[model samples]
Target: MTRESLCRLDEKPCDVELRRRRQDWRRGAEAAYRYRQREEHLDVPYEHVETVGAFPLGRWLSDQRRAYRAGTMTGERAAELEKLGIVWDTADHGFEQNLAAARAYYDLHGTLAAPRHATALDLAVGQWLTNVRRPGGLGKDPGRAQRRAAALAAIDPDWNPRERGWTVDWQRHHTYLAQLLAEGARLTAVVPGVTWHGEDVGRWLATQRRDWGRLSAEQQRRLGELGVRKAPRARRTAAKTAAASGPRTGGAAFQKGLKALQQYIAREGGLPGRAVVERLPDGTEHRTGIWIANQKARRDKLDQAQLQALADLGIEWA
Candidate 1:
């Protein structure tokens, strides 16, 4: 999700000017809180006092947490939040315990079962399991998986770690849906575009069968802003074109070179100098097409799309 979408989800207005204003307001709030403490001759926790204008710091903190969990927040941003006392440590927030419980349940059942007795925490962990992307999209990181398996085994000694999590379908069951409906929850909001009312459920389900919340063009752009990987459709299209045109020639090679350049920028956290690009993970040797693209971009010759691609990877050429 883009920062705008995250702000929307958190019910905050996304204004660059407003963000600047909030920083000043935050300092004022801290000052006022201290003044009131002295005036009242009381030692009160900062959390207990409501600041003037009741600025939405609580909501902002929650938004930061969500952004961090989604892997969209930068390290600098996280540090700023930490300074404001919004802890981002997953262990302190009980995520480890929750994850371990979910792992144990999966070990026993061999699936992320949506039972009638499932708690919100259970459903949350299941959702995470269902959506968590493996690094590089190559496969599960073996070391991390093994460590998780060991941790789960401590909880349930018979838990087998070798069982593949992907083999089990992670989709919610009808029973889970019925429970959600019974709780007066709006299913459409829970899983976007899937209405689950008395009559519209069937219609909505059929519509979902056709297209279940496929990303719009604008959302695709937003995903780029959020530093999420590009959709498989782009890769598939490139592959098809390559197959029809025979071996990759000038254009295709240039495209690959551009991609490699982007990856290098992302991994290195900057525009690579000629010497640095030579040693970058995906970068080609000096003076190749990828290197030339990097040089052209460094000289500010690329269009907005190319520049924005680099920006999405957190690369600021300057």
Candidate 2:
């Protein structure tokens, strides 16, 4: 064979190999495109495999990322991936995804004080926020962490409850109350059994008032903004108030029933029978079973403290 023909044969093999690699890359790109179409994102998990072609798209993308970072990826290939919304830094991508979830939650609830089990946009946003609120949770880089914190603060200024000298639960309750007030709900109108986002908002509000002295200055200030003040001190003594209010006073009756229920539970080591009656120490006859039933029936009329009293006594419905 002529020398020129031999060189041409070698060139042909190299061209064929190049063509094969290009075809493989195109197939992976197709799979990636499909995934983006379905999920509207290219933030595929490391273990994810595209189902349609059973393609290891995630690994392929990882390879591309490594190549890009190593400065080996061709400009054409990088441009193609970028067009598909590829994010090279998986960690940053993950953070963005979680941020999106946080935004969604804030939009719905008006705050980021989500419970540990809360989910938004199919993401465990509550847990994510909890983690991110921890010291150094954003990342080791100070600038990055600051930026992330700013992003969260944009959603709700009190996104980190601990930083504000309170627990997430307390922040959640406060947020709920603020939301109600903004919606034109009066403080008195938010009584026991009033709930918002599964939280006993009325009960929480009552607790804040009752324990007003126990709260920090900052907490009190926040409550004050919502017009929630310390519960009023009675001018009359308990005995006089009870006597003046009469024996049929709702609070007094509830207390009597609670006392009787407690005594029964202590003696019986369980809930009282629905039909059982018990006499109080003062010889006041209380149909304890019927009273319990009535309490459950009138749960909405009960205040936070009253509900808590029942709950402490093992009343599940409370």
Candidate 3:
């Protein structure tokens, strides 16, 4: 999240400029709140916006902003925002006011930024109060905080962090889409011209992944942005290829017995179990002795094949 700093009059953000920008503060604030409601970064669609002949004039623009610090707000509100993917990144986004930084903070967590932007809204609110000094010019809070608050409240009120979270969800939605495309690519690579669509892509992306959600939003966003067109299919094929390339694997007394026999050949001129050894074609190596040991265990001693495996590794012999 960006670090937010509030500029004073004629300073970094120029309080006058900040106040000028606050003309549309309600809209911007509402957009931030609305953005919190969405699981993805999508601007408010035109359909959702209700245009009054003009936005209702209100005093929300004048409230003096109390210095914001952590822990003042918590529990339901904090958790709710968290669900909306509102991670208050302690790292600064470098805005010159509390409100601007707040917006940047929300944006870092994946909430959408509104088209109505205020460069230094927080300082502007303070400046507005400064411009409209009453009995004394510019008291702490200028106009009315509630009007802006109301506008914000009016935005996507349905956003419930308990019910839905944006960061993980956005990552999931896009990654699933991307992986599907990647898998398609893989399939096409192995078999040319393989076609795919939403459903097929979904299944393909879902099929192989065991725990992709464990990845962070940045990772998720990266992969999704990369897309899933052909990568998944290629991933599967790559896995298969890797498995094929890996050392041949099996568990058995057979292996142990083979190893023992090879060692026997190394050390002994003759086999202790000649009956087992003699059956081998002259050129045949310890492989025949292993089979012989296994059969003896199965038939004569009625032992399981366990010892044969041990013997195969040359760890032991019949």
Best by TM-score: 2
Question: Which ranges in model 3 have alpha carbons more than 4 Å from their true place?
Answer: 1-19, 40-85, 90-317
Worst 10 residues of 2 by lDDT: 184-193
lDDT of each residue in 196-222, candidate 2, tens digit only: 788878778889999999999999998
Error of 2 at 22 (Å): 7.4
Per residue, candidate 3 scores C-alpha lDDT tens digits across 90-120 of 2121211343533443343222121123223
TM-score of predicted structure 1: 0.24
Query: How many clashes in each structure?
Result: 0, 0, 42
Candidate 1 lDDT over 156-219, as tens digits, reads: 4433212423122212223234444454443322222233222233233333334424635443
lDDT of 3 at 96: 18
| Least well predicted 10-residue stretch by lDDT in candidate 3 | 59-68
lDDT (Cα atoms) of all candidates against the true structure: 0.45, 0.85, 0.37
TM-score of each: 0.24, 0.63, 0.18
Stretches of model 2 off by over 4 angstroms after superposition: 1-57, 234-318
For residue 149, give model 2's deviation from the true position in Å. Answer: 1.2
Candidate 2 TM-score over all chains jointly: 0.63
